[model samples]
Target: MSLRWKISATVAAVSVVVAVALSLIVHLAYARKQADDAHRLQAERIQLLLREYHRGSQPAFGSRLDDPAVPADLRAAVRGGKVATALRQTSEGTFIWAAAGTGDHVLSLRSDYRDSLGDLAALDRVLLLGSAAVVAGGTLAGIAIGARLSDRLRRAATAARHVSAGDPTVRVGAAIGGRSHDEATELAHAVDAMAGALQARLEAERRVTADIAHELRTPLTGLTTAAELLPPGRMTDIVQERTKALRALVEDVLEVARLDTATERPALSDVALGEFTTHRAAALAPDARVVVRVGTVVATDPRRLERILANLLTNATRHGRPPITVVVDGPRVTVRDRGPGFPGHLLRDGPARFRKGGDRTTPGHGLGLTIAAGQAAVLGARLTFANPREGGALATLDLAPAAGGEPSP
Candidate 1:
């Protein structure tokens, strides 16, 4: 259940319990008071009868008493010149009897209180219904309040998710009910501040990286030219190799900067995924295996797709064992390599720019998978890396479906 429903239910349950308890207490007290008043009135009537008999006025006994069913103990007490009262419950219902002595006879009176009992029963039903109404009103009020609060929380949660998914512009404004100083508003402001800080820091880093790469490109070109002019020797070969490595690193850094700023837009078009993957694999690495299970076309940027595939194939060849396999099923592509699999940290957190995997002594600068992930994001696809239980590294890219069109045959 949602938090709104849970809160509403709790409030409603408590209201019902309190209403019922209060109603029961009031009804019990009223019933007791009614019984006490009936007894007192009965005793008063009996006293008046005894007084009348003593004065020899002799009022009719049946006028003040009904049935006059007196218990033995009560009759003896009245005959002994003491006033007595008794409550009896017989097959005919409840009665209150009071008696007192006047000369040799006991002046006794009895009252059938079944009508008063009926009134109490009617009052009980009223109280029960009133309590139910009270409970229902409270429940509705609780639901309204809970729904409003949960809506505010849901908006805040959505903003947090957008921030997590690399959109820094999303902000969870003020609280839904417009309270300025509440906890929900405070939380929203905190999240906005955090997102702003992260965006600023990341942009600053990207600027620095892009500037450094741009500065190195000129020197790197000159260095390569100078190495080519050198005499053929071991030193020239070493210089050429180092220059090539530096050039590759600079290019990767520039690409990462571009991805960070999202300066590239996908030129989406329907492309046959199976044929495309086969051609790219043949050109990039003819030795690798390619398999098409469900050959369906997808709408995507062809250049970006090739970049993604190239990175995955290169990583497989460089870091993993042979028998690299590429499989396409609908808008999903899976690349599996028989290797030691990904490191634990990479599997958990995905790829980070310049974060190298495998042995530290490896030649590549570790931006291949990062570039692939960035390109996939640009094409509206999800790229996931995992070490399958079958003991190999698996990279799956799930692309968006073709735009309002069936897959090409």
Candidate 2:
């Protein structure tokens, strides 16, 4: 159930319980008071009748001498020279009788308590209507209060989602005025503050990385030119190779910074996965096996798709054992390597820049999978890495949202 209904239901339940308890107490007290008054009035009438009998005057209508309507126990008590009273339930209703002995005659008076009982029943009806009103009012009030609270929380959660999606400028904007002290308002303020902090930190890091790569580019170009000018020798070849590796590292860093800014847009095109993977595998890793279980065509950026695929293939070849396999199965491509698989942390948290997976002695910098994931995001595809239960590492890229195909197997 939603928060609104839960709160409303809780309030309604409590109101019902409280109303029942109060109604029972009031009803019982009123019934007791009515009963006591009826007995007292009947006793007073019996006293007046005794006085009338002693004065040798006729008794009142409700009072009688030797009345057979009175209970035998009450008459016996009166005949014993004592005043007594008894209550009886009859076909008409409940009756109260009081008797006293006087001059060898018993004077008795009886009164029915039916009218007072009718009053109590009316009072019970009134209480039922009033309690119902109270419960209905409480439930409506609870619904209103719950709606307000749930709305505030919903807006805060939306802003948090925007922040998670990399729009650090998004703010909940609920912290305002006297209500700022409330829990919902406080949560909004916290989300805004967290987004702001993340924006500042990420901006600073990207700026530094971009600046360093730009500065290294000029020196790297000059170093490459100088090594090429040297005489053809083993030492010269070694210098050229190392300088080339350094230049590639600088370019990767620059690409990462660009992706972080999210300014790169995909150039979409229609491409067939079977033909594309076959060509890419041959060019990138000739020894890697390629299998197409289905023929699928997708609308996506071919260059970005190639970049993502290149990274996965390269990572597998460099860090995993031979017999790497790329399988295309209807809108999905999976690359697997028969090696020790990805590191535990890498699979758990995805890829991170400069945080190399597997053996630390691997030659390439750790930005390959990170770049691949960024490119996949740009193309609106999902790229996930895992170590399948049957040995090696697996990377699956799903482009189902933009794909059309018929599975062959």
Candidate 3:
């Protein structure tokens, strides 16, 4: 049943019970009062009989009792004119019933008469009708209350669901009643407060990330092209080094952009990590030392995989004194640097794009670790940064194998 009806039914039921109990009490009391009146009226007869007997006129009055052997004490007492309170006998002169009372209250019971039971049934019928009326009235009142409450609750629930699904514009329609006591109204206010905070955070982050990307990309592109055009023989190592830094900056910006926008989720596939590493090593780190420890397979997109490795290799070249070893085991790939270890906190946030490099002492934009970390996340992998006991930072990407696939290795 609807909430309104259910609440009304409960209220009605309780009212009915209480009403019936009260009615029964009233009826019982009324019946007892009636019996008392009957007893008082019968007491008149006893007084009259005592007066006559005391005058020596009705001496054999005790012989008519149902218990023909009336109690000797009572008979003697009645025989005397000094009877204080005498027992009553039925007017037929047979002791069918008796009672003793001085006023309106019946204090004693009679053996043969249930003087009140007959009237009790009539009172009971009246009590039943009164109870029904009370229940019906209570039910109507309860329904009104339940409906008001349910309406407010339903409005709050609807607003909550809307906000949960990311529609910040949805609002609770009207006040349930007064602001002083409306719980749903208060809840709606709370939701509005919370939504405003979330929206602000999201907008601020979006604006900042976009502005930073715009500021960095133009100069980076120019620097990369100019470096490439310079005669390597004349510029020597300078051109290569400058171009590498510029390229790293550009890549980092792109990684941030891609991850920030939800448009590029990876197309997962089972690719053998060992095989993928072999291709990457051949293309980028051909002359550099490299090793694969296991033949594990991981699920990921190839293009995103290359981006992940490229950042790792670039970071190693820039800061890690590598001799890099790339290995695969189970569902993971380890990119180890045999260089001076990561500066304490790099492992914590995995690398934020602009926060690294630029100190004359450190060579590249801190973007390398950041880019790798972001891409790894997008492709369903966790990049763990750990300091090996031996030395350097060991970065691992734990990946999941594709569904319904073989070990590609």
Candidate 4:
């Protein structure tokens, strides 16, 4: 219920109670007055007749009515039965008024109490009917207000859901009241603030991606040309290796840019972990120790998964001894190389971008694990960097499981 309805209902209830009380009191008082007046008029007439009888100087009877101190009119009235001897009874109860002289003679008159009660009853009916009408009207009005309030609240809720479901354009309507204007305005202003923040964040990320692509393309082109000019010897080998590294460098940079912009399309599907590990390990190194836990499949974007695996294998070859081991469980593809594990400090927060300080001391762009972890995250995987107790550093690329099953180990 709205505030207005609550207040109005309270007012109506109190009004009904008060009206009933007032009507009862007024009717009772009026009846009492009428009874008093009727009795007085009857007494006055009786007294006057008795007084006239006394003034005639008739012979005295040895009766109690002859006493001079008694009002003659009252005495005569009592003898002639002009005064009512028995009070008329009423629903309000009967009352008897007697002449003071003797108990036998009573100047009795019915009180107007019944009439007064009848009047009161009539008034009660009127008040009751009126109160009912008032209550009914008030209740209906309260319900109407409640319904309107509920409607407005629903509209606001619907608008909120619409906004949440990728339509930032939904808005609340104006509240039509002088006192409520500020609150409605504040709600609208808050939604505007949220929408503005999302727009700003998206714009900034796009600008960053475009800038990175522009800055690195030229150096990458020169590296490619230089690599092509070398003859096929040790020099050519060096040139070709450098050229391949440069290309990987450019691709890693592009991948990072795409990730930042959320432009990488994730193709989610169930891939058999054992088979995938076998294929990847055979392609990279035939002699590598590849371990496959049976019957584990996961949903992932394959291209991103391949990128992450390649980065880890390459990193392992550079820093670790030969016979790198590849393990596949349901939602995981781990590459562990039998190399001196990463330094403890690096394990916690892996190698920095382009920082060339490791046991291998390889002279090349150092964007391997950084790109691996980033791409794993994009594919909804957990990439853990840890040095194994047995002696090598382990990189576990954990992927999300297929629906309706626990995640694969």
Q: Which candidate is the best by lDDT?
A: 2
Q: Please give the TM-score that candidate 3 achieves against the real structure.
A: 0.48
Q: Each prediction's Cα RMSD? A: 3.0, 3.8, 10.1, 12.8
After superposition, the stretches of candidate 1 with alpha carbons farther than 4 Å from their true spots are 56-60, 63-80, 84-86, 101-107, 174-181, 404-409
Off by over 4 Å in 4: 1-212, 215-237, 404-409
Ranking of predictions according to TM-score: 1, 2, 3, 4
Q: Residues 1-409, candidate 4: write the lDDT tens digits.
A: 5555665576667667766677677767866676667566545643554354357633222223433444445455565444532235545475433232223443322223355457657866876787677667766766676555555556666766665543544554432222354554566557657756874676576577657766777887887787788677998888788778767666776766666554456888887767777887788777788877744767887777877887888878877887788877767777888887877656766666666454445655666777787777678688888887798878887777777644343
lDDT value for candidate 1? Answer: 0.85
Return the TM-score for candidate 4, rounded to 2 decimals. Answer: 0.46
Any idea what lDDT model 2 has? 0.86
Maximum-TM-score candidate? 1
The lDDT for every candidate, in the order shown, is 0.85, 0.86, 0.66, 0.64
Worst 10 residues of 1 by lDDT: 59-68
Per-residue accuracy of model 1 over 1-409 as CA lDDT, tens digit each: 9989998999899999999899889989998898889878888888777777677756556534223567787878776677878888888889888888766667777788898889999998999889989889999998998898789999889878877778755777732447656778888888888888888998999899999999999999999999989999999999999998899999999999999997689999988888999999999989889888777778999999999999999988888888899988878899989998988878888887767775888668889999999999999899999998888789999988776645543
- Which has the better lDDT: candidate 3, or candidate 4? 3
The C-alpha stretches of model 3 lying farther than 4 A from their native spots are 1-202, 208-244, 287-293, 357-360
Residue 240 error, candidate 2, Å: 2.9
Go through the candidates in order and give the clash count of each.
0, 0, 2, 5
Using all chains and alpha carbons, the TM-scores for the candidates as numbered come to 0.89, 0.84, 0.48, 0.46
**Model 3 agreement with the true structure over 302-331: per-residue lDDT tens digits:** 888888888777777677776787776756
